[model samples]
Target: MDKRDYYEVLGVSKTATVDEIKRAYRKLARQNHPDVNKNDPNAAEKFKELTEAYQVLSDPDKRARYDQFGHQATSGNGGMGGFSGAENPFGDFSGFGDIFDMFFGGRTARGPQRGEDLEYELVIDFEDAAFGVEEEIQVPRTETCDNCGGTGAKPGTETRRCTACNGSGEQQNVVNTPFGRMVNRRPCPVCHGRGVIIEQLCRECAGQGRKRVRRAIHIKVPPGVDNGTRLRMPGAGETSPSGGQPGDLHIVIRVRPHEVFERDGTNVYVDVPLTFVQAALGDEIEVPTLDGKVKLRIPEGTQNGTSFRLRGKGIPKLGSQTQRGDEHVRVHVITPTGLSERGKELLRELGRELGESPSEQTRTFVDRMKSFLGNS
Candidate 1:
């Protein structure tokens, strides 16, 4: 059976906002969830479909690719961009953590929450990306204050329960609807969701409980990393706002342009310009490889734009150290120009000695032209 459209699966429009999609998925998931609907045999399948649709539509890159290429582009990759569903769409959604939070209670225990994730684009040489390199980088992140030990209150001062929310960390607003009064719960303005008010601000962090610091981090880039590739480093992001786990740091790879080589996935491509005589009469040629120069055999009567592959001369596979890609060399025949009088005469004599007829290239073009003009 053909798969249903992702938008249709989630009952959302294609132009729906991220928040809208999330809310729709959550509402439907609660209804069709296997645990919620044990009597319905197909509830598990429906929940899976909802999760898959939410995962794809929630990611910006995957959604763009799906919009252009449809499901054919995003399937069979385990997940988009080599990641599992637990990491994206819903950050740190492993073990259905967020869903469980909603099913049980929302944000009831407000201990140290995890820090925010950070992204940095690191540009490197093409060779470095092809191989591997270790480099040191400086990243600016917010860390817990040392003066007050992560507490916003000043030394010897204590935090008191918020007067507005009465230590609930949230404020309730009652609105009168047509049916009845609707109550909306929001974070307390005085406590800012902390449920407590600091009498005096910390001297160092100004009551923020965190300070901006530039930290030096060392990163080891693996081989065969391509542009836009994101590497995750755990515990390297900003410190938790309330004292929880630190978020992961993501570094995006950007490879510099090479003068002779262009990379496509695991393959490397290079153009080799050969003289007409060399192409017509086979010769052993020296070709440039990433490591060093190697001899390449040019077959006799080799045509222009003939490509040859050198195995195991390209980049290593991303996760496999033993497997490597091939290097492709495209040989282009260069026609000699700026001929002297003697050189032209010699060429004319050689043409007559060989044959007065047109070469294969010229004959093929002439035949096409004649056919196009209806003179064939």
Candidate 2:
């Protein structure tokens, strides 16, 4: 059969750059690879033709000759001598392994891999989160078996080398292709790439090298750790299946909402109820803080929703023992409700003394809003 043009085979123009040629070849090779398209009888032939075109065009010297003399340049001593040989027709194509690995489950010999990490949602009280606390938490994780010493063998009997792969943990498959035998190395099926076969199963762990057990781990939670804060505990997770280093345990902090206080990063906020008389006259009143109740001065004419900062009275800063956050005490004036006749009379008298007319501040605010609203 007559061979197709090299550029036409790869679907690339003669002026296409080396990178463009490589990209086009990879896309076509992946789609037409014999293993990927087993049902298509012509897939292997197409793939072989694509490889032949790529081998010549990819090399600069060969490509120059082919561009000048066409298929005549690839016929003699300078030619590839057809695809049948001990030599790989694909040449130094680096992307061949990637395509091969993708089609066939290209897993190498299994080695000791690190275990999976674990996440535990630790619900701590608001006070506990504000103040650093050492908590002993019970974590369910996989640990190496004590009886068989993580060998998955009986106490007396020992594990033997895998006969299927000859203890190499991998098996090489020789595939007969048009371009000679291709060797594909993958993990052994008998030993599952462990290189050893355990004839006697562990009595305790039931052939598995690890067992599930609940372990108590102490975690020192730092102060000012807000909700969703993750505390990583190294080597405190599940034991590795292949005997590598254990994974880390992530302690995700879930702070219980406080009844009295709300926290933001480092600062703490608390709404304190104040009597109208206390707000009007100004008095030293006790307000709740993270530490304890602290005396806050209610200045005369303190309005509702007035916030006062109590310096260094909030939650302690994380990782800094000396630095602390301020506590904001927002005062909400409690209006006198279900008042007696005498109480009402006293308030009326106080109101009359204060005057019913709008204050200077109130009049200025009203005028600004009227102007903003385009009202007279």
Candidate 3:
């Protein structure tokens, strides 16, 4: 089959930027990957086709040549992965490291690469979840070394050019084949693609360029932050292995269980038990809140399982809502288990005077069955 245009294969224009090209290639690779669709026999062929197209388009020099002279310019030249042995396909390829680093999550020729981010789990009290509070947390992480100034080098010395790659950081070779000569590029083992190497390791950081230490960081957790919420602290993560830049620290919120209250998102839920007399006579009772105790009134004849809402007493707003959530207190009327002799006599007299009986008070399906049977 005739080869498709490189731009069409990658779903991009010829003028697409390097980042755009990489994004397009990654998307295609994922869609047509053989491993992802093992049942499909054509997936591997499609992947190989796309890979070949990307090899030329991803390279600035090869892309430029292909753009000017079409396939004839790169006919005899090898594609990206044509080497039989260790060779840098990108030996003459400029702007290659930046593209590689962006896709593969590593430091390339790009300067000042940020460090790896760290995550720390934090547990807070129930009251703290309602009302925002500040607390200091001790986080053990890899931080930039102060002794060698984040460089993994001994004092009064610096990195030298790698002899293996001759400062190119990549080894390149051309392979002779029956069809044509193919060129390939691979990272130099000695230099590890850095183009430079430290002759003497740093004494303080042990040539790793970082030191592990504990830091006291104060975090202001906003109200309404529920369990599993994450707060990001910039420049608080581990130091970059290449001494490029500091990473960020992620604080994972773990709200401790409250004795009386349970939170669901920004809303607060609590179960309040009330006496039979209090529910019937209507009385004010003390309700616990994040700030302090507050008074709540129960209306007369308030049945069990009744819920009363206290507006603005629940958890605070996250980022969108301006008003706070309301607190819901579910009421459960408790009957007295133990009664004195005087209380029993008074209850007997009241029941007698009020004519309260099983037949008069009961209106269940059994009572309807009696009516249906004409026994009522």
RMSD of each: 15.0, 6.0, 8.0
lDDT of 3: 0.76
Model 2 earns a TM-score of: 0.72
Tell me which of candidates 1 and 2 scores higher on TM-score.
Answer: 2
Residue 53's lDDT within candidate 3 is 76
Question: What is the model-wide C-alpha lDDT for candidate 2?
Answer: 0.85
**Candidate with the greatest TM-score versus the true structure:** 2
lDDT of 2 by residue, 175-288 (tens): 777545566787799988768999989989988778899999989998888899999999998888877889999999999999999988789999999999899889999988
Off by over 4 Å in 2: 1-110, 173-187, 357-376
TM value for model 3: 0.68
* Cα lDDT computed for each candidate against the true fold: 0.84, 0.85, 0.76
Between candidates 2 and 3, the one scoring higher on lDDT is 2
Model 1 segments more than 4 A misplaced: 1-111, 156-164, 174-183, 357-368, 371-376
The TM-scores, one per candidate, come to 0.67, 0.72, 0.68
Residue-level lDDT of model 1, residues 1-376, one tens digit each, is 7789999999999999999998999899888866568899988788878888887888788899989988787667564633445444334345355664664455345566788999989999999999989989999999988898877789899888888898887887765522233344677888887788998999899987889988999999999899999999999998888668999999999999999999988899999999988998999999999989999999999999999999999988998879989999999999999999999888888778887535865888988998999963
lDDT of 3 by residue, 320-356 (tens): 4576888899999998878999988877787778778
